[model samples]
Target: MTVALMWEARAVAGRGADLLAWARAQHLAGTPLRRETFRAPQDRVLVITWWDAAYDADLPELPEPDGTLVGRPVHRWRFEAVD
Candidate 1:
């Protein structure tokens, strides 16, 4: 089964673009089958990556962007397809 990993972060006031740029340059250890990014209200950036790995497998994730650019620590979640 394939799993999707979601990572999200909120940029500091007026720094959303910088945060997005930083995320775009990230390089995870494994190549994802698919990847996407979104911009949300309140200066948030959401990144979802599809990988051919188990939900519980240890995988390399993007490191947090510089503290000055984010309002808080990054959040992450893992999900397996149900359909």
Candidate 2:
């Protein structure tokens, strides 16, 4: 099974760059099949990671940023590939 984990967060005003850099610096305990980072309007940062595991399997995910860096709690989702 292939699973994709999505992590998204909104940085505090004017702290988007800092949040992005912080996110980029994080390291996972296990390597993923693929990983990518992205940004959107409103200082939102999104990271998607693809893994070779069951949808409900335990996986290493990026941790939440410091309170000063983010405006609110981070959001996350999991999806399984479909054919």
Candidate 3:
């Protein structure tokens, strides 16, 4: 099965660039099949990772950024691919 994990976070005021840089620097213990990073208005950052594993399988995820850099807790979700 194919699973896609989504992680999103919002940065504090005037810190969008810093947040984006921090997210890009993170490294997971295991490499995903595919990975991509995105930024949006309101200083939001998103990271999506695709993995060749079961929906419930244990997988590595990006850690939370420093409190000073983010405005709120990160949001995350996982989805299983379907034809």
Candidate 4:
């Protein structure tokens, strides 16, 4: 089974671009089977990474970006494939 890791963050006012750039440059360990990013209306950046492992497996996750760039702490979710 595969697991998906979803990480999200909101940037400070007028800093969305910088936050997106920083997210684009990030590299998570385990060499994800697939990775994607999204931007929301409220200056939010969302990153979803698919890995070939169980949800409980120990895998490298996207590290937190500098606190100065974000309005609040990063958010994360983990999901296991259903099938």
Best by the lDDT measure? 3
Candidate 1 CA-lDDT value: 0.90
RMSD of 1: 0.8
TM-scores of all predicted structures: 0.94, 0.98, 0.98, 0.95
* Stretches > 4 Å off in candidate 1: none
* lDDT (CA) per prediction: 0.90, 0.96, 0.97, 0.91
Write the residue-wise lDDT of candidate 1 on 1-83 in tens digits.
Answer: 78989999999999989889999889888899999999988889999999888889887787888899999999999999887
Across 1-83, the per-residue lDDT of candidate 4 in tens digits comes to 89999999999988999999999998765698999999998789999999899879998788898989999999999999996
Candidate 3 lDDT over 1-83, as tens digits, reads 99999999999988999999999999999999999999999999999999999999999999999999999999999999999
Stronger candidate by lDDT (1 vs 2): 2
Residue 30 lDDT (model 4)? 60
Instruction: Please give the lDDT score at residue 27 for candidate 2.
Output: 98
Residue 37, model 4, lDDT: 95
What is candidate 2's lDDT per residue for 1-70, written digit by digit as tens?
A: 9999999999999999999999999999999999999999999999999999999999999999999999
**Best-first order by lDDT:** 3, 2, 4, 1
lDDT of 1 at 22: 90
Assess the local accuracy of residue 9 in candidate 2 as a C-alpha lDDT between 0 and 100: 99
